[model samples]
Target: MFKAVGKYVRAVWYLMTFRIDKASESLRMNPGVVSANYDRIIEEKRGRINQYKDAIAAMIAQEQQKKDKLKEVTAEIEKLEKLKAGAAAKARQVAAKYSGDPTATRNDPEYQKCQTAFSDFSSTLAEKQARATELEADLEGLVENINRHKLQIQTQMRELEKLGEEKHDAVATILSAHEEKQIADLMTGLSQDQTSEELRELRELRQKAAAGARVSRELAGLDTKQAEAEFLEFATNSQANDEFDSLIGLTNNSPETNNDGPESTRIPES
Candidate 1:
């Protein structure tokens, strides 16, 4: 009589904990409502992620344009500097040619021509030098702007990555909750026989997967053997072809013999 009373008490506790309390909780937290909320959160996060990605792409494009502009400015500066150097050299040559001659005055046509050429070259050189300096300053400004944009993009990317991780974790949590709720519902509704049948079906699926894996491994082995056989056959054929070619060349190079009659009737060479 005492053992029967103890068994009845345990059964009541099991029913309260696993069935009644679980049903109460399920009624309190509706699966449809929870799923809707999770979907909304996911959609909002995805929109933010797309916005950040688009901003980063725009920043990258702007940075590229700035870099191209800087390159152009630098090239122009280098070209101007080269031209200035050539102008300076020509001025020096002209000065040297007209130097140490006290009789050669401004009245001399050659000296005047040399002076005009040197003056024009000097003017052009000074103009180019000033333009190069301006371009260098512009290049420096472009570099600074590019660097600023890069830093901004990096910060945004870090934030975007954090947001992505958070979204993934949220999705995982929501999915886990959903699966748990589904399993609880299944347990509440399914009979023992039905549960057993489901387990047997799952076991069969596992067996099929195992068999498929075995077949895949066998097929892979057969493919490897086929490749090896093909390689060996190709090597053997290549070697035979090479030997045949050598034999043919030797036969072709051999001296031709006239066998019109027997050896006694053949003409003898002097």
Candidate 2:
């Protein structure tokens, strides 16, 4: 009778464990549970990604504005530098012309002209120097801001990386193989979309920057030509032979004129 009772107890214990194992397996493989958990994880990751994307976009916009302003300031600074150089050159030429004449007095028309030109050049140089200083300070501030933005971007990227890792961990822990694969594919698709958008924006920015640079270069070229022409005209009117020759030399050595030689003058190699 005791043996029979022992057998009955062992049977009851085995049956309970079998049911428990079956229930655990059911829980693990349940489609509803897996789907719900997968969705939740994906949603959370997407939310974080969207937040990061928005932040990055705002930063990029701000950086672009700063870049544009920097470009403008740089171009202005370049123009001011050229103007200052021209003024100095003019002052030197005037001084040299007057210096060659020992009989020239302060009251002489040429002497008076030299003094006036020197005074104007000095004043203009001082003004431009001050403006250039201000622009340099502004450029430094913009650089700092750009650096800050870069740091912010780095932080955002790190956060995104961490979030990605967390997403993978969450998926691995809660999802079945099929569900994990689906979520992975979805994430890949979303990532591709984001990458494409970023590429498009970068391309657009590059094109705009290139266009702006081209326009700036063209304007600079025109200004340079105008300044050169004006200087040459002043030299001619003043009968400053040496300065006129120097200006002519500069014109002759210009890339445009130098490259305009006859295309048919090629020597054939024997």
Candidate 3:
């Protein structure tokens, strides 16, 4: 018994769920509901697009920052190049002062200072160049990524437009299909439409009204007085017809001028 009760409860739940799902599906098929659902989807997509734009904007800003940093590094490298050239020129001047004495030039503190300055400037320029190269590579990657993201955004926008068109088409198709189904149902005599039912009711009423009128007219004709009146009218018409025939001399009558006699044999004047 317990098992049976549990099964019954499960069946009831299943039936309820099925009914709810069917009702939901029916409501969802409505044009207004479908349109609203599409609108909601569009709004969600727009929100996502806005978020994507924000992210792209951030990437662009970072790319600009990298570009600015690369510019600064490039400028520093140039300045270092100039300083190294000047240091080499100063060392050459010191060597000229040595007048062919290589050992004296090597020991000269001024020459040593020039050498150290050039070495420092060269190292700093190399470091700045490397930094600039890295920044340039970073900028290139960022630009490519930004471009790809922009293309994706454009594609998504086109998809959104397509979705908008699809929404309209879907609604129209659903409405047309619903109308067609109603017509088919009506043709098959399966329609439960209130209008169809009302029209049938009106037709029945009209038929009843016509039948009632006919019955009323038949009952009136069945009246004895009516039949007598018709008979009297027919007699009067017949009398009028005979009088008209007499006036036209179309009636054969016994001549009053005929000789008064019952004799079968009477000589007639030729």
Which candidate should be chosen as best, given TM-score against the real structure?
Answer: 3
Using all chains and alpha carbons, the TM-scores for the candidates as numbered come to: 0.35, 0.33, 0.80
User: By TM-score, how accurate is candidate 2?
Assistant: 0.33
| Predicted candidate 2 versus true structure: per-residue lDDT over 1-270, tens digit per residue | 999999999999999999999998878566566556666765776687577667657656765675676567567656655765665566456557677555554446655665566566567656655765675676577667657766875776676577656656655665566566666776777434466678889999999999998789787797678788999999787656554555677434444443456763567679
Query: lDDT for each of the candidates?
Result: 0.66, 0.67, 0.91
> In model 3, how large is the Cα lDDT of residue 119?
95
**lDDT-based ranking:** 3, 2, 1
lDDT of 2 at 217: 71
Better of 2 and 3 by lDDT: 3
C-alpha-based local distance difference test score of model 3: 0.91
Total clashes for model 1: 0
Question: Could you tell which candidate, 1 or 3, scores higher by lDDT?
Answer: 3
Q: What global local distance difference test value does model 1 have? A: 0.66
lDDT of 1 by residue, 1-270 (tens): 999999999999998889988887775456455555556665776676567667656655765665676566556656655665665565455556768454554555655665676566567656655765765676577667657766765776676567656656665776788787668876886534576778989999999999998799787797678789999999999867766665677434222232233884668999
Considering TM-score, which of the candidate structures 2 and 3 is the better prediction for this target? 3
Name the lDDT value of residue 86 in candidate 1.
65
Residue 25 of model 1, lDDT score:
74
